[model samples]
Target chain A: MKKLTLVLTMLTLSISISFAQEVQIHGFISQGGLYSTEYSYIAENSKDFSLDLQEIGINFQTDVSDKLHLGIQLLSRDVGVYGEGRVTVDWAYGDYYISDALKLAFGRVKNRLGLYTTIQDFDFLRTWAVLPTAIYDLGLRTVNATLDGVQIHGNLDTKLAGNLDYAITYGKLNLGRTSDIAAYAGQLTTYAVEAATTKYNLGVNAVYNTPLDGLRLNGTYLRTEQFAFDPIHQTLDLTQAGMGVLNFDYHIETDIDNIYAGAQYLFNKLEITAEYNMGTRHVKEYITGLNQTVLDMIGKGKPELSDEKYYGGYLGATYRLNQNIGVGGYYQIYMRNDDLDDEDPRKSTSDIALSLAYNIGYNMVIKLEGHFVNGLGPLSVSLNDELTGDLSDLEETWMYGVAKISYNF
Target chain B: MKTKLLPILLLLVFASAFAGEIMVANTVNPEMSAADVEKIFLGKTKKWSDGTNVIITTLKGGAVHEAFLTTFVKKQPMQFDNYWKQLVFTGQGKMPNSFATEEEMLTFISANKGAVGYVSDARAGSLPGNVKAITIK
Candidate 1:
């Protein structure tokens, strides 16, 4: 703890010294209440509303030279079982401008995956209290937010095609045991699991700013490999028919590939956005003690899991009423098909959401949002720890409401 | 007839009060287009035509600042702030220098070679010898 206090003191002093120069300090605080009608969305089910969702972040930036800059952001958040007011370094990177069309960044930088992922936590920058759950799911926040490594980005201007902005990044991500993904994965096993770590992550994103005003087209691609320790299990032991028992010291390896395409257009006071995402995952389990009987019972010749594919997208529109108020709505759908059967309701999910936001002042905003969800989707499985059975016992339809207030400066 | 004309005259006066024009250091080349101005302020254009770095400055809050954004940058103050914040947080770009008044803006632009800024049209005539208004075409 002495080292931690020393680090904090140094950070405070550095911020103060930078402020004396040309540093920029900006921050935001957001608080909200979430209520579900049938099942829990982000917290345990309760008769009264839950105020377990909130976030605060502070960002500091300064230029070391004309072509070199540094930035860092600290964030603390609480959402159900994750965040819990833990102050973490969201991003800290050094950027060097090589030229007019080339720049490089190193350290912990935000991942440029999709349109909304880079700015996912900045509620003051969006019209809704929360982004679309299908694309920017809260359970996958840590995996999608930042990477510790290097990034190269720039813009290319053309006479005919307008401007093209591109970014390529390579890095590794550290996933904590308490992360939402680990917690959810742990529920699938009986052992006390640790956090998963990635071998490496690579991504590329490009955006074409068309000649048409307020219109842009974008595409992103990312690939990563992750390894997690089961440490006490091969797979969920189905010997007791779903009442599984675990063996010891196994390794789970997964490879993922994702692609996203998005478009945005603005006309007068109206804004329209649409995006589609597709992902594929391959999983291999390494178990120490595996017999032919276990393999035959699991219906697999080897300890390999079947490949999974999922696709989802959303179409959204927002209309501004003067400058202080805005109204928006969206329809989104997702399908997870490990069995390749479209007839199964468990494979498909859908949701429709409506939002109203009012700017209380230049730096403060209040938003009210509602969502009606259909089908037992990924959210239902990951969010609720009580639901131990399969999709057959899950609620098919549910609704939730949220009221959020935020201030930024 | 006079009563009806009074509101129109007052509206015209209000609009004219916010009318502003872009300005640059006299050392900068005189061949900048409105598109170039837009690109420079948006951080899309990092250098001048002569390959010298481009310095961008803005007034924090004023009629001229509002008019400059609406007429050229095509964004509100809040939207512009959010845009730069996004870029800064993502390590793509940095915020330009901002002044609290037109006088400070003019002083900085006058002292710098590649500086670009805006001022009210009425105040354009008072610019010093080192600064000049660039017509947006």
Candidate 2:
């Protein structure tokens, strides 16, 4: 933490000097709290809730010359981790206006993954407390958060009558090492678990907007793959011939494919948006050799091998009460299929959440949200239990409320 | 509601009594379509034809300018709600600088070469040497 602060101060000084010529500083800070009733299966008891600073970022944009513009964003984001100082060279490149129809950018840029991900810069474009959790967890960003590649993205507008207005882009996905640790309340130890993993990725996406008279319609699609670094394999041990095998690790080379589509309609005072996403995840379990303790846990559990699929979607709506204020609501649902043996409790389960918000000012907003979850197949008595077992009448529903406040400067 | 409507009617009467013209302009070479103008005001048009940055200035808040936004731009003033929502939600663009009144708007417009803005159309002819009003109609 001290190292992060020191580096930030030094970089701020340097940026304020060299690029101070045309630097524009813009950012915002958001803080909020969540409280849940007995409805929440995870939080069975009502607990004192506290608001933590979500994200605070400063973006510095400078124009090097006529053809070039550079931008760098330093953000303090709390994603499971306490605070990760994530720095992104968001847009460092040149734009050559070849014509009204053709323009090219050579540098790190947003790939327009979804209608809002590319600009996830702002806080109010969507109905959720934040962006759809599924999109953020599944969709691909430039390098990790921002893409490090070149792109030709622009809109096509024509004056010769019946033509379409559209925006498009293509780019490479981030395939880098991801390492982070997180901790929450009721936990004495700070370092719970760690993940040292890597992935190979590639992606492409586009969105088209068509306006007819007073109404507007938009649709978008994105696809990407993440191939883990290790191969998946499974092994078994019998009494005489202690070792047996079923290697699924060979499939590790394959990448997961995620696809999504969404449509939005906006008329005078009301707007509606709906989106759906699907992805294929191949789980690779490698167990070449096993001790008796591990063997006893599995209990001849078919070499302890399995795979599953996941998919989800969200729908939202907003009504403009006046020019400066509006009311909105949304509901999101997600499902994960864990294809395991009949005894496994953590099978396919569905989760849903609802939210309502109001735009108070140009930079201030208030959001209230709740979650309703059911058909949660199973629960583990201990956090690290590998063999998840079903809970007696585990079928439960829970509720929570969240109020969020944010500002942009 | 009657009391609220009364003040608004009076404000409209006073505004019409002292209505003024507003002028608009673009750079020298390229022609700007209505769609381009919309994008410029919306902060999507970052660069001008001559390679200068585009600065969008507007009155901070009110109904008159909101009406102009709804009519000429064909977008809801609540789109401003959507705009800030996008900024806060997606982190794309920032809200443009604002002026308190039409006079201040015109003054800023005259000072910045690449700046674009609006005021009461009745005051259009009185713009300064560096400022000109492009026709919205």
Candidate 3:
């Protein structure tokens, strides 16, 4: 059905172009090589080169009239186990310009959640091959990047304060057969979980351009809803708990609230950036089976639902030695549960990164970066680093490196 | 004749050295603030003060192009290009039309309503009657 919709949309766009207006097409392609130590950072095993990161995209934009425009981008990526190289409609929207203070857009619109949400695949735009992982998780790209809904956005100028570019959006998530959310759930628990949802998401974003050149301040808020999973592949086999290997089915539900504040300053050859975001999640679980009663009796009588909060941010700076060479780095941290003690291994994850990039020309760039990491954020240490069974062998301190080359036109 | 032409030649030499500066031109207005020029080119200001859609044009790439963009948009050429490309791909705005020569850009601005663009000061000397060179305040 998604493929059919894409074909129909493409056909309609082609017809419109042939009979009515001119359309501009642009695209980019990037490939990356990765290697990590002490865990399955990106590959099946650590310490081996993995060429699992790749991306390709093509976009179309056309002005149908003085006050109307249409645009769409089809993107494909395979980064480890996330995208799997399937083409997706990254964003497809129609915008109507009502005036300078207001514009209405409908369809799959990009979410301006943070300084980098909309530029996830724009490798050539920044010196970093990947954004700060603490806040911009690659695993959540499928849903956090864009939405299928409506948006109202515009610019307001205040003579002394500067210009405010703002947008408000409401939409629904496109839960598909293959989504990162399901994979993320499976990683946390050894189960075949499928994500199902029809909940709507809401977001508001605004950026204030400072009177000082090369400086801007941004703030954003988002309320996103998703995640309802059915019973696991099979119920838990609780033989050790005196329950004779019983079975039970359970369902899970989730809701999320997010807030972000950031600023960017660019002066001459130097650019500095800083951002912080907090994510609050509410989760509820429903157990249906006789074994659940025994589970409560075993001192595991925790509440069926609870609210948890996580936060992360990064401070980075990039400098251009010349057009051909640039360097950047950032210090970032992600607290999976801020309430946990500071020294707990599961409490948080932090990484310090350094990157260098060289431009081959105006159209191509090559970047090399390294990340020194501490902790696994929320991932269980018991997870099989090699996916072969035993997750008991792990390290708190690890490092990874990636080199990528990208081209666009 | 020699005395008179020497100062004229000196003045011409000085003007030629500074003629690399780009002048914002449009048929809709004869003058505008540099701040407005910055907003218009960045896709932030979509409509003119008169409510007509602001049509933006650009030189394909050259010294004049770089000077105008860096002077107003405050971004390097490639960064500016990347900025618009990001907006275009994200379905946020349209890419400004680009021409290889200043004359072609001039023709586009003259023919289109509310069209705004930058041209070499040398080209501003002979603008069409419909197109006016904007005075950057």
Q: Which candidate achieves the best TM-score against the true structure?
A: 3
How do the residues A216-271 of candidate 3 rate in per-residue lDDT, one tens digit apiece? 99899998775566555435666776557666666677788999999999887788
Task: For model 2, state the Cα shift of residue B91 in Å.
Answer: 7.0
lDDT tens digits, residue span A32-146, model 1 = 8999876666766522688988889987887776677777788887876567778877777777888767989887778877788998887878788878877887767877898
Candidate 2 per-residue lDDT over residues B1-137, each given as its tens digit: 22221111000111222234242543442234555556666655676666556666777766657765665455676576456444432333445667888778766665565666666655554555545334332
Chain B alone, model 3: TM-score?
Answer: 0.80
Greater-lDDT candidate between 2 and 3: 3
User: What is the TM-score ranking, best to worst?
Assistant: 3, 1, 2
Model 3 residue runs over 4 Å out of place are: A2-19, A230-249, A288-303, A339-341, A378-394, B1-20
Highest DockQ: which candidate?
Answer: 3
Q: Is candidate 1 or candidate 2 better by lDDT?
A: 1
**Cα error, candidate 2, residue A41 (Å):** 8.0
Arranged by DockQ with the best first, the candidates are 3, 1, 2
lDDT-better candidate, 1 vs 3: 3
Number of the top-ranking candidate, with lDDT as the measure:
3
Candidate 1 vs. truth: CA RMSD?
8.0
**How much does candidate 2 score in TM-score?**
0.71
Candidate 3 structure quality by residue, lDDT tens digits, B1-137: 22221111000011222345555444344456667777888988887555556778888788888877777778877778778977876878767988999888877766666677777667666666554444555
